[model samples]
Target: SLDGASDNETKSESGVPEVPVPADDTPEVLNKALSGLSSRWKNWWVRGILTPAMISFFFIIIYLGPMVLMMIVLCIQIKCFHEIITIGYSVYHSYHLPWFRTLSWYFLLCVNYFFYGETVTDYFFTLVQREEPLRILSKYHRFISFALYLTGFCMFVLSLVKKHYRLQFYMFGWTHVTLLIVVTQSHLIIHNLFEGMIWFIVPISCVICNDIMAYMFGFFFGRTPLIKLSPKKTWEGFIGGFFATIVFGILLSYVMSGYRFFVCPVEFNNDSNSFTVDCKPSELFQLQDYGLPPVLQSITVKLYPFQIHSIALSAFASIMGPFGGFFASGFKRAFKIKDFANTIPGHGGIMDRFDCQYLMATFVNVYIASFIRGPNPSKVIQQLLALRPDQQLHIFNSLKAHLTEKGLLPLLEEAA
Candidate 1:
């Protein structure tokens, strides 16, 4: 079957195998049901049916809670990595290259171990400190990560063949680049998740809303092409998606901000031996009244601070997010292929669905660090708990003296 699949592949002008054009394997039942419709309408129907199914499944994951959602993100990350690497494999016709696939996966594991190790140390510091082996690993996490990466690097060097040096090195670079794109971005997504489910959900929801609204507008009113790479993209869609995403993001943030379950940061609960999302929500999620602009000075508006921030998130999603998709389109064109792989009936592969998401995740992470995140008191307390008793007492006295000088210590004591 492998041989048959390879034989069917198209060769490029350089004699390298091009990725095969993905066959439309729409389910037979859908095909029969839509047989009377034109191909254009048939495609719309297929995407319409499958997109909601995907969205519903996504909501179900969210409802199931963060742990399951995290597992799903990881699985999607792996799938996206596989799709990209598989393309590289076909393009280079490296099936005969010894251990190419194995090495790729090895590198993936090394990087994930490195990223997740840092995450555990940051979020689950207490749990990690309680376990001797985990404590050691966390302390030496960077060293361990570097050593693991070096092992893979050495293996790759050792596996290099005499005449196949160039091709092997190309594949090596390909593997690392894929890791940077898929793993690094997905890691950021998880980081955003721990901040709050809203951080994870609102941005993703904006992107999805933009994508759907863009398609709808373009299908009905496309006149000018937006880019040469993606012929189907139109300015009409771009503009429509932008406005729709902004409104959707604001509304979504408003609704979610009111719920403690959505606004609270995810933290580990040692007593329950599980993760928990319960806290006095930060001011970002609290409603505040604001005087209207000069144009409407007579009116006042009450809004969550996050809703104002959502405009930034949505603006980037609508305006710049499509670039990610365009970049993937250009990559596909270079390889002379259609979709990444028909993993989704009408949506190509998991990577196709996520190209823009990776970009949005990066933006959201940076945005939070820049604008929303403040010095976390919990983290400070955790660090204090890890210090020696004398050191903790020393810092405590310093803080108390400073607060007393500011005339706040007596007030705090009286309140207590």
Candidate 2:
């Protein structure tokens, strides 16, 4: 009776309750059993485990995360460099790079323009074709990029000369570009694996997974060698962590998503005739889709990552990703700092957390671009109807209809 009462209490949707029916299957007992199981599982891992598990979960959301993440990364990179400079300023401080305080914005522009050129291009193309307010940026991204690179390069090369000790300027100014290339490409590649989340998130997931696993493995099984730099880490734990990534990657590839033609967690907003995902499905209801087709009307989620891709990519991240961490450790060893900074308990500095991601991004990016890019650049995945099927020719009409509805396109065009 208590079991029946409890079941009714839990599943009841309204204040008025219907009479409980006795059946061959004791639903009340089943409910009690499920509740007990849930209680046990909840007790199995407390907040410490749950918190990281959740971060690791979002860490998996990087397929469509670049637009937002790299922007966020702009801030993180500055803070990271700030931390590095505070710790290791002796090297570049003497060199005198013109470390612009607002460099993050400039860096973001370069990064966004470089990797997401297609969307950015189509966006502005739509804008100008429609005779919209902000339309000039569509025609000449390359020219602008080329000019910026040229000017920055000139400054960098000048710094290499004997008279120009502009090493700092050369390093950071160029460093910004270098970072833009490496990280953005890396993200693009990883993002391709699922096409739903942003690519940066995949590498970030692998790195965080490796970190958490290494810690758990080391904490419980502390006898073996995890790696050289991280003395406490054990090989047993490391292997275990790697397996965990494989499992999660495999599982995450199977989630419910409607936006990606070939990715995970991608939310399909049909208005733009392209696949893009924000943080969650709720964001689709925001002001962005006015001109776009409703996601339900035009979007649908298809196949998930089969065992092969998940196994391969996760394995790749597990093995090669660590090299990035090792490299960071080597850098740390050279400087002799224990942690990046005591920002998070148990977790070290953001750089320390992101070390593997920085490295893994390159590996992931190259693989994706190669796989997706066809013999003809324009024809890359051209056989697929998604990107190539657009009937909208005039850029302005498209922009006014597509981007202006989102309200973001106008702002980005104006800012650019």
Candidate 3:
């Protein structure tokens, strides 16, 4: 009778059907399956092919058109750092992370001034001169550096004193890392420290390459679980990546041969065709014989270019890069985030993009600051001054004319 009435009213109710809510375990299981599927698809489809394409585009700009590439690199650093600070601070929500970020914004501004040698008063002047009272050595210089640091420290300490220990930790940890990074990179780029830059660059590059390669190889070949924290990873892939990165470094040293490299040529040394990091700018900038080979022979007489020590350095980089990535992965897991934010379809967030860069910066900063930069500190100022057009052509030409009028070409050339 229930099934035999008019079409609309004839349907059975199936004894009061129930709307089911899955058990707690069901969601967890589904999440795992979904994550696995997503990881597979993203890595296979986007990261694998697209990463190379992006890198190719990047290389094209870097080689054929560099100004934009440099700008992009600098911008990426700025943006990534901002995100790192943001995510790192998220854990300190109760401790006023937003305020800390605001302070950082101001700190960056002050740092720009300190490095660029610009001041608020400079805007009022039509032309800045050597005598501009606002130069680094001026009376207000120490005052400014002190004030900036003190302000930051006070804010940091106050956050802790207010029971914002979490934020305090972030601020404290980052401050140290910041000090380390700035000290290292500034010593190389600004000071032109060759050895430090080399050790740092090699390690940082190796580590970054290791991270990328691990992600790649693992996504394709990984089967065994490497760590519970990052379930998608595998020991096989890790091993492959570690070696791959070392090889990548060696190859990079080989491919980018015409530029600064760790492996000097045979003419540079007679140690039987190995690799070495004991490189000199004179060698790198000039041809093989007159430039680098002899400089290396004078340094590492016994070790080949690809000696044990050289491998050690590359190994450090290859390892550290993945270590950094693992650290980032742990942080992400704690937050239960898929990626830092989805800025890249596959790459996750800005912090995700720079997780390796952070470690690389640290690696480069350390080596350069410790041994490679050597001793000179004032070279940057001298170089920048000499590089100035007013000091280079105009001033030199005028001096040359006076010297020539005095009939002193020998003295002029010697003085120059």
Candidate 4:
């Protein structure tokens, strides 16, 4: 009876399970070009072609400088938010729900206003003080941001219909989660950029290098699976990518450290009415000699301190960054989707490409705050500039006294 019932169910069209389409997005030209190859090889070719294009786009963004890069990050964040929110809407089948989408976007604007306002107050204090309206905004930015968010909250509550109450709340939770993942992480990325492009670029490049190297190794020599969450991931790929990314990171850091434009923290220049990257290099960017180990005492080594830090960053990118991808994979599986969207040809969506990037951004931000960033002289100067003349004079006298007590004033005076 059981076998007969199983046969009947399998025979029924509605009972048949759906399988995910692996490479449904081949371009017409590529499709024809790869017609002679099997599906596996065709996918490899497609990814190989698109991967470099994405990296090239990244290079172009870097060439455009920090402002353009910031704009691009903002755009990607918004796109990722949209992709996630759209997925939530589709999952809940709440197309008919009123005001959820509007509220989601409104909250996004409020959050951006808050984060960017803080950034302006922190880094562009002179500009804010020069403009009366901006000064006023900066003075009460947090309160205004909270008020805006509250307004969105109230609107969301008012929009709730009786029958749609549960679904509406679920969407509310979904929107907040999306904001947490997309907006907050992107804000950290902008923060990392301000520290230096090296901070922003190096960790991100490590992740990218790992992703590419792992995929290449896996494609060619995968034998054992790495994780059940990502079936295609392999142990060989993991090991190979770790070493590759570490070496890539160290070498890249060495190259970037020599360029002041890449090493200097970005700051607003009051004289030029624009941003500048022209500060003297930090100790991290300076090369230092190290004595060799007992076994290799005959040899000497010189390296930028940043390169040593790169090993840690690269290790995290290779080891932990893939977990972000795995988490995304699990999420997609839960939703019964092959990809986030049909946005990128070989990649799934902008979010698909950026899921691990967001994780790397957060990590870099924390790493800078914890280990790299020091007492910022520019920030201290900015604060002093904002004070009354008497207060500034008081601070100057106090600093002089402190230096004199330490017996360093004579040396400073002589140098001056």
Q: What lDDT, from 0 to 1, does candidate 1 have?
A: 0.91
List ranges where model 2 is wrong by over 4 Å: 1-119, 122-135, 154-194, 198-204, 256-305, 370-416
CA error at residue 349 for candidate 3, angstroms = 1.6
lDDT of 2 by residue, 194-304 (tens): 344434444456567766776576567668876787676578877888898888665554442234432333433435745454544323212222222585566544333
Q: List TM-scores for all candidates, in order.
A: 0.93, 0.56, 0.57, 0.91
Q: Indicate the TM-score of model 3.
A: 0.57
lDDT of 4 at 401: 98
Error (Å) of candidate 1 at residue 67 is 0.5
For candidate 4, give the lDDT: 0.87
- Candidate 3 stretches with Cα past 4 Å from truth are 1-39, 64-73, 88-101, 111-142, 151-205, 260-310, 368-416
Off by over 4 Å in 1: 1-17, 404-416
What's the lDDT for all of these models? 0.91, 0.52, 0.52, 0.87
lDDT of 1 by residue, 283-372 (tens): 898999988989999999999999999999999999989999999999888888888888999788999999888899999999999988
Give candidate 4's error at residue 195 in angstroms. 1.3
RMSD of each: 3.4, 22.0, 15.5, 5.8
Model 2 C-alpha RMSD to native: 22.0
Backbone clash pairs for candidate 4 read none
